[model samples]
Target: MAFDYDLFVIGGGSGGVRAARLTAQDGHKVALAEESRMGGTCVIRGCVPKKLMVYASEYKESAELAQSYGWDFDLGPFDWPKFQQHLESELGRLENAYETNAEKAGVTIYKSRAVLKDAHTIELADGQTFTSKHILVAVGGHPNVPGLENADLGMVSDDVFTMREMPKKLMIVGGGYIGCEFAGIFNGLGTEVSMFIRKAQILRGFDDEARGHVADCMKMRGVTIHTGCSPTEMEKRNGRIWVKGSSGHEEEFDAVLWATGRNPSTKGLGLEEVGVRLDRGGAIEVDDHFQTAVPSIYALGDCIGRVELTPVAIREAVAFHKTVFGGEPTKMDYDLIPSATFTQPEMGTVGMTEEQAEERGPTLVYATAFRPMQMAFAGGEERVLFKMLVDKETRKVLGVTIVGPHAAEMIQMAAVAVKMGATKEDFDATVALHPTMAEEMVTMKEPVRTLD
Candidate 1:
């Protein structure tokens, strides 16, 4: 069978770009199509830009803390325009890098949306068609916003980066990581932030204790969080966004941000016409090898709704290349993947939570909470949490969770230990570094609680 290319990738996201580059480098005819930017969500609007905003927001706290260390200066208001200019410049550099790498690998770039025409043929938005031995779908996902009264007045997470002016008062609806993170970001930037969550607490799927610690820290830092209620209707009045809550409370704010949820970007890709199976949430369903029901097609990353992290997408791409092109069979291992939430007191976790572990079998939990030296000396009430979950019979560390400063960095190191099936004794044998929050990971000798 004659084909225009050996592989035709239908997205330009992290997974799609990596798979396209790898397949082209393998001396296969490869082409990738993207409707908008090259670096997709992570580089353009999601992780990179969000983290930069987090950095910018943290400086106000840093500046205030400097006074305790004998530093003197009045920090001014946050300059969003100035920071946004720099952010756009950095994003441009990244998008160019993605293009350069793909071009270097001899992959043809199509700047249009591509959809499956048949099992191995793709049609683009601009009346172009290409046939390949195999087709890959990696379109990722998009923010999910419900249709409510004046909901269009609210912005999603993507809109936050491009906002023209910083709001004096911001209302964030939803309690997921995105909402919690932005609440901290805006609050630290001196915006009065009010978070509305329909649940009793934020971070629904995380460790309860860790979630509690972070929620407490956020409240102490002046974020007004409303739980057990959500916005039922919204309206604009006198230049302010008026939101009517489920609890019979009405509040007006300068801006309202919705981080409700996300849906897979699998619409109108002609998946159903080509006999590809999608789950109830419209996420493409694939087998263990990421192969669709049709032998010549495959899907992965956010479109599959497995793990929506950028690194996971990149890994999936690599595994896909090895399995299909490299003459080596590979299966992705999804165990013990560490993740972090960039909240005020950040959260990092890997493997199973205490609730998850106890549900499986007998488990032993070690937990500690204390004020860090820096915060203690500065007369701050801030605290750090370190917890480890171990299987009682195997004596293996099943999970690790940290809530406090540098939780993200510390959890990366802890992930290695948990992934290696290190036992409680392995941690105990590692000598503790004195006067450090991380030392708590190794120094918690006794079990705080045992679950039978």
Candidate 2:
């Protein structure tokens, strides 16, 4: 069954949606195959819903912050059901928006699972096979459940957002970004959160100082963090799950969330049947331009298993479309990307960390941590930390990270400097924004320390 189209995309998540719609906009006949909902993991499960919970959790923080602003009133107990209803309604609105937008863009969408019967051809779940000149597997990633005793008792990131009722206690099983973010959401909503991680620290690959500050802030906010620990067994005891770990520690909780990590979402896609190469992590082996071993097939997003953020997926999808269809093509510059953790004291970073920059040569680390000016009267003791990595040789700013109010917003501006390959002198040359937390980027006076 050959279809007349220039491109076909599978998995209508962030990457899939953009690839299909944008390619269609370029006057290429494009078809998208999605097994479930059209909107990808980011819209339905990952980023959108999680951020909403973050915003919902912040209202509680706001009341506490209100005390310092000379406003006093009795805050009502949070209604979990009310929030769940609102979240569901908002999700409905988003689904409608996605459908309307795709239709307007003239993309043919197939609401069925797609698998490769042969290279350059996909079989729909409903017994339809469509062949295209180009096939993109943007299927994204899913929870990586570990194999441990009572591992079946642990819930993944997907289960956390769909929780209808509140828990007496939640013992989250992973200490990575997903687990840490959920820990913050649970703690902020007044649930006791205990975390277990295999490494000495949470967010193991992130900048050490920023990670340490976040771990401390989370601890202060009442999240019991357990490092260098792995749960060995689990059992149901007294209406709770009893978790016995190798650390010789035990805890009981209403439920367990295993935000341990995620792997590429290419399950049952039949890649092996068509000779597409897979990396160690089951990620589609793609070349520099995101082309798989078979050039007719392309893959991006979590399916490629690196830089699994939504924006990165979008960039990959956009670039893939442009390279194949657009007259001029641009390869993705993996560097200069910025991301933030929605956890307490919300951390944001762009470019090299102090540790990363040191591999080049001697590097200067400019760091400052203090109470936010707005927090001085807010009664809450929340603080912001800013760190920048610069080459002592060139004084060019390599990266910037902020862990405080609106850290994400701050790092976005800093990313421009990083993308332009700005040095330390570039940061020094720019005038400060004044009285805003963002000004900290241009206001560092001393090297907190130099790293080699």
**RMSD of candidates 1 onward, in order:** 0.9, 1.5
What is candidate 1's lDDT per residue for 1-452, written digit by digit as tens? Answer: 89999999988989999999999998999999999899998998799999999999999888888988899989888889999999999999999999999999999999999889889889999888889999999999999887887899999998998999999999999999999999999999889999999999999999998999999999999999999988998988999999999998889999999999889999999998999999999999998888998999999889999999999999999999999999787888998899999999899999888889889999999999999999887899988999999999999999999999999999999999888889999999999998788999989999999988
TM-score of 1: 0.99
TM-scores, all candidates, are 0.99, 0.97
Error of 2 at 362 (Å): 1.0
Compose the digit string of candidate 2's lDDT tens values, residues 1-452. Answer: 55666788888888888888898897788888888776788888889999999888778878877876878788887788888888878887887788778778988888888899877788898898878899899998889888876688778888776787888799998888899999999888888899999988888778989999999999988999888888898988988899987899998899999887888887688997798999888999988788888878999998998898999998888888778888567788787789999988799999887778878788899999988788876665767899998888888778888898789888888888788988777777889987888888888978988887
lDDT of 2 at 322: 79
Model 2 Cα shift for residue 305 (angstroms): 1.1
Cα lDDT, model 1, residue 447: 93
